[model samples]
Target: MFRLALKSLLNRRGTVLLTVFTIALSTALLVGVERVRSEARSSFASTLSGTDLIVGARAGTVQLLLYSVFRLGEPTANVSWATYQQIAAAPAVAWTVPISLGDSHRGYRVLGTTGAYFEHYRFGNRQPLAFAHGEPFAGVYEAVLGSEVAAKLGYSLGDDIVIAHGIGRVSFSNHDDKPFRIAGILAPTGTPVDRTVHVPLAAIEAIHLDWQSGTRLPGRGISAEQALTHDLTPRSITAFLVGLKSRVATFQLQRQINEYRGEALSAILPGVALQQLWSLTGVAENALRLVAACVVIVGILGMSTALLTTLNERRREMAILRSVGARPRTILGLLCLEAMSLTLAGIVLGVLLLYAILAAVRGYAASQFGLFLGLGLPTAAELYALAAIFSAGLVAGMVPAWLGYRRSLSDGLAVRT
Candidate 1:
């Protein structure tokens, strides 16, 4: 019976092929969206794997995360160096990495941090930052480039690059005199770290010495050498990553930072903040998934249309089968089986296409956008989605199957013109 059904489908190979392609594309789109969304979440969650809390000036948790972690926006205010030191000195705090921003090299963000950043920072399952070529910055006028920065700008160790006055790509006022040598190039982490430029905290202070009130002082220049001679201690820092001595102390430390009388500050659990951010953006994610679901429904509807339209052409074939004692029930089952088969084929094809495309572009996406897509098997949710599509296909076939059953009964063994 299955062989006969396959033969009948092959006879209408043109329409069958077209329907298969339509369903295949829809399946690919649906599965691809889910895959990308899952990977994006994973990549984002892994960005600060080992950090216990992120402390920043009083602002929205999402805002602080964007500036401190993703380099998305400028901080509203800075935590005073005194405040930072106090937080670091807390008994519950095991370690802290001070971060100072507001500087830029070309268009990439310049992150002023201590050597402790490289030592304590982790991503993607507590993975430490590995050097691609050289060690971390040691000298005052030295900088370490992220993988993306080095690859995009064609920079290498010992290369000299100047910092811009602001974060803009086209800044008129460049710190031309304080050129920094590329001290190191970090291996790709498939996170925001891949896009940042790391320099000593002193470098951030050194570049701003000649400037007063966000503008260069008129006719008073402080060369890099002269600036280094002065106390380059930062008075304020944008934020700091904190690791607690024990997991039990997390809430205690967070409460202490939030209520500190020294300065208005906020300390957030990174995991909690990330979940909140995801929830805020859940609407868009759901919208994308809904659109993909609609596409799958349209594809199933198309299969139904193709089968119903072809029923009239198959009337004579149905009559011949009835003459040979084929039951009306058999005819109905055949149509249903054909629809399910087509859907299954399309799903298999779509999955293959999805992975093939991912395998081809995974490296580029990681290097350019820091989005790492694994070539792993589909998750449980994806498998369930595919099963749902298959079930929908069967349900969609019921309409054409009913029609075929009714016609076979009415036109039993009759020759139709």
Candidate 2:
């Protein structure tokens, strides 16, 4: 029966092949959406691990997280340097790394922070940042490049690079006088850290010394040497990352920071804030999944239509088989087997295509979008989706199977046109 089914499909290879390709495309779309969505969530969740609280000027927690951690947007307001110091001085606080934004180097964000950032910042299962080349920035005139920044710009240790005044890629107000030499190159962490340029907090201050209101002061230039002789203390920073002495003090310190009398502030637990961000994005994710599912349905319907059309052309073949002692049920089973074979072949082809595309674009996706896709075995959710698709295909085949049974009985002992 299986041999007969195989030959039957081979008889109409052209249509069968097209049907398989359509189904393959749909299967790929469905599985690909799930894979990318799952990996994106994992990447975001692991970006800021081991941090207890993120303190910043009063704003939405999600907004603060996106700007401070992911570098997606700008801060609504700056937190005073004094406020950051007070938060760091809290009895329950173990360490704090102040983040000063508002600078860019060739489209990548330049993050001005202290050495404590390398010592305390964690990601991806409490993993500490590691250097692939030199050491962390220790001097105000030096900088450390993230893996992506170094590779994309072809920068090496000791290469001098000028930072721009604002976050835009093209800035007319470039800090040309005080260019920073590359001090270190960090190893890739598959997080946003891989895209940042790290510099000492004082570097941020030194570059802005001769600027006012986001522009260089007219005819009043502070040379790099002269700027160093003056106070380089930062007046304000974008935000700060805080680690607690104990897990128990997290909530207490968070409450204290939120209610501080000196300034309007907000402290958020990193895990909670990350969850909120994911929930907010859930709507769009679901919509994508729905679209993929609809395409799969359309593909299945196309396969069904192909099968129904083939029944008319094969009526004479059905009559010959019945004359050769084939039962109605046997004819029905043969048609069903052909359907299953086509679906199974499509699934295999789709899976192979998916892995091929993943291998080709994995590195580009990580570099361009910070999305890391791995070529591992399908997750349980993916397996379930495949199984459900196979079941639906089987059910769809039953309709043609029933019609073939009735047609075999009616057309027996006579060759139909």
Candidate 3:
């Protein structure tokens, strides 16, 4: 039966190839989307699991996460260093890292914090920032660039760059006189950290010391040397990344921190905020999945339509099989086998195509977007899609198979489709 089916399909290679190609492209779409969804989900969960609470000015949970973790927006009001100190001094607080963000070099955000940031701030399940170049920056005028910033700005160890105040489309003030030398370059962390520049919190104050209202002290120029001697108090910090002393105290800490009287501040669990984000995005995700399923259905329908339409032309062929004492069931099996074979071929083609695309853009995607797709054999999602396709093919073929069987039954040697 299998040999007969193969020979029948081989004789109709042109039409069979088209049907298989259709199924293959649909399978690829289904598999590719699933891969992105899986990897993106894994990336989001692993990125911020270590932080117990992210403290910032009173804002929506998503807003706070956007500003603090992804650097998508600025805090409306910064928590004063005094407030940060109070939080750090709390018995419930295991450790704290102050973050002061405002400046930018080109497009990458510059973070002002202490060495404690590098020590405690984690990504992907408490994964520490690994260095690719020198150690952490110690001097006020030294900077550590993230992998993305280094690659984008063509910066390396010992390179100096000016900081610009305010993350605007354009800025008039530049800290050119007090340029910072790159002390280290961090390895690719696959998070927002990969695109940030890190310097001591004091450096943030140092650069803005001689300036007022986002410009140099006009008619009162203070040299970088003279500016160093003067008091540079940072009025506020963008936010602080906090870790709790005990895992059980998360709720207590969140409630305590949100009700703090010092400022309109709030603390949110990174994981919870991410869940909220996914919940919001779930509608669109489902819509996309539905569309993909429809595409697969259309492809299967196309295969069924092609086979059914050709029944009249192949009616003579069916008659010959019946004359050779091939049962009506044999003819049905042959038709069903063709559809299943087409679906399987399509699965193989689509997978091979995806691998080719991944190979072509592996470096570009990683360097430009920091998205690293791990190439391997079929994931469970791909396997599931393949199974679904084959099943759909079988169901689709059954209709035409039944039609062919009936025609063969009615006209054993004189067929009419």
Candidate 4:
């Protein structure tokens, strides 16, 4: 019976192949959507691993998170250097990495932070930032380039690069006098860090020595060497990352920073803020899944239509089988088996197709969009989804199966008329 069913499908190979292709495309889409969502959440969550709290001037929690971690927007105000000192002095604080933004090199963001950022900041399972070449900046005029920044800008160690006075790519004023030499290039971390330029906090102050209230003072130009000779204390900073002495003090410290009287401040748990950000933007992910589901339905419907239409043309074949001692139940099973076979083939083909496409584009995706896609077996939920699709295929075949049974019964009872 199985051989007969296989031969029968081969006889209508054109329609069968089309149905298989449609179902395969649908399965690929379903699996692809689930993988993207899963990896996106993982990538985002891993970007700030092991950080206890993100402290910034008073602002919306999401806003603070966006500016501090993602480097999305400008801060409304900066926390005073005095306030930062107090936060770092708290007994519950294990360490603090102060960050100063607002400078740009070409189009990439320039981050002014202490060497502590390299030692304390981590991502992806407590993974410390690793250098691809050379070491951290040892002088105020030295800089380290992120992997993407180095690649895109074609920068190498010992190359002198000047930063612009503003954050935009089209800045009118450039800090031409205080060019920094590339000291290191960091390995890719698949996070925003991959797109940033790192320098010591003193470098930030050095570049602005002749400026006050967001503009350079007239006739007060100072050379980089002269600026370095002065006290380069940062009066304020954009935000800071905090590590706590213990997990139990996380909430306690967050509350303390929120009610801080020295300045208007806000402290957020990175994990909690990340969850809120996802919840706010999760509609897009859900929408993609919905579209994929609809495509799967369309594919199943095409398969059912092909089967139902084939039943009419195969009536004579059904009569011939009935004459050969085949029961009506046998005809029904044959139709069901054909449908199940097509669906199973499609699921397998789709999985193979997905992996092939991912392998081809994985490098491009990571470099272009910072999305790192892993090739692995389907997750348990994905396996369940495939099983549901198979079950749906069987149900789809029932209509044609029932018609074949009735056709067999009628062929057995028909007269010459």
**Which digits, one per residue and each the tens of the lDDT, describe model 2 over residues 50-95?**
8999999999999999999999988989999988887799888889
Question: Lowest-lDDT window of 10 residues in candidate 4?
Answer: 408-417
Name the lDDT value of residue 52 in candidate 2.
Answer: 91
lDDT of each: 0.90, 0.90, 0.83, 0.90
Per-model TM-score on C-alpha atoms: 0.95, 0.98, 0.93, 0.93
The numbered model that scores best in TM-score is 2
Which regions in candidate 1 have their CA more than 4 angstroms from the true location?
Answer: 360-364, 409-417
Q: Order candidates by lDDT, high to low.
A: 4, 2, 1, 3
Model 1, C-alpha of 367: deviation from truth (Å): 4.6
Q: After the best TM-score superposition of candidate 4, give how far the Cα of residue 366 lies from its true spot, in angstroms.
A: 1.9
Kindly report which residue pairs in candidate 2 clash with one another: none
Ranking 1 against 2 by TM-score, winner: 2
Error of 1 at 91 (Å): 1.4
Clashing pairs in 1: none
Error of 2 at 107 (Å): 0.4
Candidate 4 residue spans exceeding 4 A from truth: 169-172, 211-219, 409-417
Better of 3 and 4 by lDDT: 4
Residue 160 of model 1, lDDT score: 97
